[model samples]
Target: MTSLASKLTVIVSAAFEEAGLPADLGLVRVSDRPDLAQFQCNGAMAAAKVAKKNPRAVAEEVAGRLKARGEFAKVEIAGPGFINIDLTPEAIAGHLSAMATDARLSVPEMAQGETVVLDYGGPNIAKPMHVGHLRAGIIGDTLRRIMAFAGYKTLGDVHMGDWGTHLGILFNDYIRSGEQDKVLKVDLDDPASVSALFEDMSERYPRASAASKEDEALRAQAQEATLKMQNREAPYYEMWQKVKAVSIVGMERNYGMLNVHFDLWKGEADVHDLIPPMVDDLKARGYAVESEGAIVVPVKRNEDKKEVPPLLLVKRDGAFIYGSTDLATVVERMQLYGPSKIIYVVDQRQGLHFEQVFRAARMGGIAPDAVELTFAGFGTMNGPDGKPFKTRAGGVLKLEDLIAMGVAKATERLNDANLAKDMPETERASIAHKVAVAAIKFADLQNQRQADYVFDIDRMVSFEGKTGPYLLYQAVRIKSLLRKAESSGSETRGFGNTEIQKFGDSDIPLALLLCELPDVFEGALNNYTPHLLCEYAYRLAQTFSSFYNSCHILSEEDEVLRGSRLTLCTLTLAQLELVLSLLGIEVPDRM
Candidate 1:
């Protein structure tokens, strides 16, 4: 399963050591300019500087030494000291054939898998799902699946935002409006009523804030309710449970739509009891101090002597801020899972918050030194205006609205393409929805996680370009060809990869790309960026398209050549599906 570049480097690296130069100097990579060669090693120049010699002279000596290995057809010294190694057809075919029969395509699992606890999908109680939550849910969910596939035991949690002043606002508003009995006595099992109550509260929440701003009595009631809720008063606690229950309805439905789920619905309130002791412990350890009548735990940005604002643990009036609960949750998670790592798949806005929490946890001994904490922050899903996404009337777009928007664009495309015009109405509906979900997820996942991307439904669901639907359509085409081959009584499996030795020239490029799948996956995992995997998928799909257009598969007169092409097609389909599954995209057999 050694990569072509790695094998090339291994043989050449010994030459460097034999020549009394740096041994691991000639690290090779797939060449950017394919017209030149398949791979290039530019490390000789750096090695020359290190050894105080002419770079070209060093490269020539390295090339002379590499020639004994008999792998490269041509190892030419290019610009400065760049050594471009063109793999012999025999070498390329050997690797491709090896990959053809091997599962994992050549990517091996890590020697030691981690027990990871992933914190994501920060859905606030009483609030409906919004576009803001989409990234965390999609990214975290995909990471969980990928981690498991990569042999890590992953535990994904929905960090529900249940303990906050907002809870008090919703409670007081409902109690004052005299609709308390309807929520308590009515069909609590009805999702509609729960959703309706949540939606109504969401709408009135801002009004409640505005009213309380000028009204002292209302403000007092809200604060009192918050204190009571935290203190476990029967009324506030009971209403709080309803708040969480109703919110789960929306959370589950929206997350399910995106194929996102959580191992635990552990919210802020779950760690409430721990917060008091945790804050006191920090205070006892002198990590926490009183400042301006509030308790705060100051955290440093680094080992350097610079300092940022401290994380406020509690206000003067005894109501806790988010920081306290976050620190407590860290303690609780460590106690429960004893995980190797806890990755927080949050957006970039909370970058400072997490840094502070992690630091505070470590500073206060809440999180152990053995446990690794990572904040996998992503960018926002913005609208065309370059701000956070919104609807036609400039209101914040909900998750359901985004889904509907995607489906509509997909439906419009299906109509324009006249695709599946003969299909049943129900069948068309199902296909369009799958396309929509796939399109939306792919569009977001393709972008670098920390860079904001505009959400454009029309561009995403289009069957052309690098959209998800295009990939799905490509996969479908491969399935169709394979099915046709099988139906014609053509032998599909048991084709020896010996035929791969005959593929050269135009087909060589595709073969080379296919063999690099393992390296591409390793690079993606190393960086914690699925966009790397997305890039690999797009390139593979594009290369396979070129191969399909040039080399006929099912229609080829020669059975051996046809079988080789079919094998390539099957391998491409498997790897494409693997990459898509990692990015949380799905492919249907039919377009």
Candidate 2:
């Protein structure tokens, strides 16, 4: 299942060696100028520069050898020594036939056995998730899927922010409000009681958090509560556990709606115990020192062009901060999973924070140099006003509410289009849910992760353009086409047939695009850019649409041509579905 490009590179690389030049100069890529050739190699230009010879002369020598091999239909030197290649129709057909049968769709397992840990979905306990958490959940889930598809063992951690000062504030407020006894006595198994407790805490938490910022006494009490909880003291620790349990119920319900599941439901609490020892090790090893009463890791280096503040691990009051927990989590992950890489899918604004943490981890010897600590930071999802999206009241919109809006919009679109009108109510509901999720996920994933995008449910749920529903519609269209062909007694047996009668105008382009699937996937995975795959999927759908419009399959009298076209359609659908799945999008059988 070697790709056509790889095969050509091998042939052309050998030609470079035969011409008494460096074989590495034979790297071949899909031609940028599709009007001239199917593939191009600019190696002769580089080789000429190194060998001090005319690039055209060098291209001629390599072209002569390539022509002798007879693998390409045409091998000609283009302007200034670019080698443009045209594969024979038979060669294209051969690759397409192989791709039609390969389950991986000719995509190689680039990562093989590498282990990767993805940290995302950082929701705090007692606080409901908001639209701000949307990008992290969708992007991280998609990355995990893509990495897993690339043969990497991936562990996705929701990394809930359960153990933090916010919890301490809630605890202080709960104690003063005399609700601690009720919360303690409530049965954890009773969903209603737990939900009520969580709701009360959620309401009180905002008030307490706001008050702590204004009242020095309440702030000190919260800080003390935090230290006590960290020390596993009395009812505070037990109450913290109860709060965590109730919060998890709501978290699971919300994340479940988005179809974002984490392999590990761990959080700051899981690493709290490791923080003390890690801090001790850092201080003992001279990586951490007291900076104005707080223990900080000085990560600033001489080559730094901008200020790199020291990572504060412990405050003067003896409470550990986020850096301590994050550093400890890294230690725990390395010791537990031994992952070769850990990618943090967080907001781009936290770039400096992660830089300090990564520097401290390496400087403190907490993480080995071989393990990559990367920050896959993303930009904000803005409203039409170019500001962070919020409810009309200027409040942070809940994640559940956002999802509900998408679902409602999707249902309305379905009704307007008169699609799924005859289906069962339950089935229609399921389709709407799928469509909603696809719209939301695709809208977020279609952008470069580091770039900001406006949230437009209306445009995203449309059945036309580069929307998720459009791709779903195209996939459904092909499925319907296949069903009709099957009913007409047109068996899908041409998948293994390599002898295509003749290449139509659109057929070769579709075939050539199919061959680029592996390259697209590799590019996406290597750069952690899902937009590359997004662009490819949209183009593939559009190309297939063109091919379908030009070529009539079921009505064709020529059986071979009809079968060949059907095979192309079938392969296109498989690839389309495959790419969609990698984007964490689910395609319905019909739209």
Candidate 3:
């Protein structure tokens, strides 16, 4: 269905056309003024300015020539020649019922399904997962789900940073310390122990390097050892395998807890060999140049950083940088999937890096408009000290431990609420566990992506205000009401398939509330913001509460009115459940 605003504007424009006025007032938009009416048109004021006539006269003249025609109850002139449209109760009821019967939630399908790739959940090898990774995981997963619901084929890639100098550092540390076996059993989150090991390794590597340099024979032996590890030579190969095994197992546990899965977990190491040919092509196409023995993309440098140097594609030592790896991935995606769009759920700090890559991709003739890039910025979790987030002892926090903390906090609230008091103790605990995870996911996603957010468990797990658990509570409440209605053999009379059926004598408030869903969905889709959906859920919950308080569906004497209202209640619950699902929030049956 065309939205209420879209439908009304079309009718108003038709009236203007019939009155022999200028039909072209450019495009019009529905103004946000609930105090006046449902929809308002401001085109007349602009048209008056263009025609050198008074705005009020133009508005009244347009209104006089307009026929009522049942689309709206009244069209009155409001402030400064704005046309305030009051749609009929029948119109609101009809639109809402149409949404209930339709499966797309009244959202339009794409003209043709498009292929897009979402890069998120970036966990570097040998680095512990932390809250820094949480934002990307949640936001990217939501975006992928949203696009897929809108019928786009989306590939969710983790884009792991599994190859880099850090790997070399870790590998070298393992070799020198002769703790190759311990690498296989290290618990990455025991901050006290892990920090000491990492620091000791870091300190010893440099000292050993200096000593090796002073003794040429020793330096040669160390170089030989590194080569063996790189090429998967006998003993060093076994050691490298052990480190990778520990790291992958740890990352998988985190992903499992987060409910995140990647369509592909290919790392920079997987695509390392593809970089050289891409670099050669960039050179051949004049897109790259040699600078101090390193290959560089010749994009104009940022004037803001006068002292900072240009981006180097390859180091002077002929090692490929992350930029080269990203370039290769972009080319590989274009050639493999031929996607029309690509979204990177990376940080705002990497904005310049992506801009460089996008320009290079365009120059490479991959897809001029074929690649679309979006960088989602995230906030850091700070301790009580208010510095960049760290443990009390000043170590990085692991993601798994943070989630566990959320779960523990959530369990306490659920127990205090006594929501499932009569249920078996074990079952209550399991439900609380899922609810806790949902609360964490919802809290992170309820805000706009660009803003910084504090990870406060107390604020996140509360059952009031704009929160995940609150939304879940509303859903559970609706389910309870519906179950009661069904047990009593209540027959519900759904508003039928007509696009403009009347609501009869039923209170129009519930019908009016239901009509707002299409607007909510439209805003959510176009703005690329899930918070809009959160706002919708909040309003829906409020509307349901208001409906229950003012109108009693179960006790109304008139059977048709009672049946119709019951149906409205049932349909509202379904819509609420669908919306919560869209946001990745799960509602427990018993709350």
Candidate 4:
């Protein structure tokens, strides 16, 4: 369905075109100042510049032409040269009827499709997922949902960090096999075992990474073990499999808790076999050049360096860096998925690295279209002293701990409110849990993804202001009112059997607010801004509050008036639920 703004734009364009003027001068928009009218057109100013006429005269002439048609409830020329339009009651009522029935709420889906690959939440295999991975998970998941809503074919790839130099370090440490006097071996199933393995590996890897720290025979054995694992050999591959399985299981718990799910979980190991041919192809095309003892792609460097740092495809010792493997993966994706755009949701600190990879891809001529790479930056969750967020024990905080804290606070708030004391304790607890999750998601989403925000549970769980709980509260309140009306036999009658009440006889705040739904969805889709829906939800809540306060739903003396208000309330609740759902929030029946 065409929005009111678009319809007006078309009408205005035709009016000017009929007058022998360019159509570009015609534009319509929601009013910046609501006191003037519902909509305002600045086309007179643009038209006057080309028509060689006075601006006020042009506006006056257009207003007269529109006035003769009687399409607007009120039409006037204001200021220097603007046409203000007040939609008639009939027009608003008609539009609202159309919106109430339209399932998409006038938000159009894309007619042309684009393929997108979103790479996010790149966590190493041996390490615990931390706050550092938060932004990628949230932002990328949100983007995936938005793009799908916009009618695009989107694939979310959790590019697991499974293969890298870290493999070599782990291999060396395991092969040492000396002084193995511990009575119990590390178990991957237990959290403590997993934690200790990571802690011990982190402490030992840097020392073993040095050339002089190990004998030639030990280094050779390490390399052999690394190759065996990569080739899926027995014992070595079995051990690596256990590590990958355990880590992935742990990571899935985090994603599930966050309401994040990936369409694909392709790992670096999946592309390892293709790396050799990719390097050969680069050599054949001269994109790979011999530099020093290693094969590299010589890149431009800063003024401080006399020699440009090569991409380092092959180390002097014939080892592949991540850059080479990534280049190979790009080729594989181009062949397998054939995406129009590739969006990497990696960290902003890797900006230079993506630049190198993109340049190398263009040089390789593997893609017919330019690959679009996007980087998202995140700030640390700071403590009271403004450093990285940490526990009272001065250790890194786990993602689970943060979620648990938010839920605990939300439960406390629910108990304090004493909401639904009649309901079972189990049900109340479940409702509280949902509220907590919604609160955390809403707080994280309200801010711009690029900026860092303080995750305050107290502020987030409040049932007032622009918080998620506030929106949820409004929804539950509407449901409560409707349920009350239903029990009292005051629910809205079918439209055909009901008489539409006069607009001026009662408050029309909800009607006024209803006009903004199409505008809100349009803004969100175009700008990729869910906050637009957040604002719309808050306004709808505020409008409902005003209506509830000033007017009586069940106490109305006239049947039609009460019925109309009931209809309005029902529609308002539907819209509130719709917009909140789009923001990835759900409203509980009570509280």
* Each prediction's TM-score versus the true structure: 0.94, 0.95, 0.85, 0.83
lDDT of 1 by residue, 253-313 (tens): 8988887879998899999889888888888889999999999998865665656689989
lDDT of 2: 0.87
Which candidate, 1 or 3, would have the higher lDDT against the true structure? 1
What is the model-wide C-alpha lDDT for candidate 4? 0.70
Ranking by lDDT: 2, 1, 4, 3
How many pairs of residues in model 2 come into backbone collision?
0
Could you tell me the lDDT of residue 194 within candidate 4?
A: 68
Give the per-residue lDDT of model 3 (tens digit) for 367-456.
567456555555555445565666665555667776777677766776777655677877677667667767777788877777655666
Error of model 2, residue 180, in angstroms: 3.2
Candidate numbers sorted by TM-score from highest down: 2, 1, 3, 4
Q: Pairs clashing in candidate 1?
A: none
lDDT of 4 at 59: 75
Model 2 regions lying over 4 Å from their true place: 185-187, 416-419, 492-502
lDDT tens digits by residue: candidate 4, 1-591: 656777777877777677677776668887888877878889888877788888888777777767766568887888989888887776766666676667766666863578877787787776567666766776677667766766778888888887765665565566565522111255766788766665665555555666424578666766666666666776656666656766787789887877776898888878887888888988998889887888887566455344435577766666666787777778888888888777776656676777677767777786554655554444445566676666677655667766777677777777787555677888777777777667777776676655556755356556457777777887788788878777876644432212334464345557867767777777766555566777788888887887787877777776766666766777788888877776666788987
Flag regions of model 4 displaced more than 4 Å.
Answer: 47-53, 111-114, 166-237, 292-317, 370-394, 452-463, 491-509
- The sequence of per-residue lDDT tens digits that candidate 2 reaches over residues 316-371 is 99898999999999999999999999999999999999999999999988788999
Model 3 vs truth, CA RMSD: 5.0
lDDT of residue 383 for candidate 3: 48
Candidate 3: stretches off by over 4 Å: 16-31, 184-241, 301-309, 378-387, 417-419, 492-510
- Candidate 1: Cα lDDT at 295: 95
Error of 2 at 313 (Å): 1.3
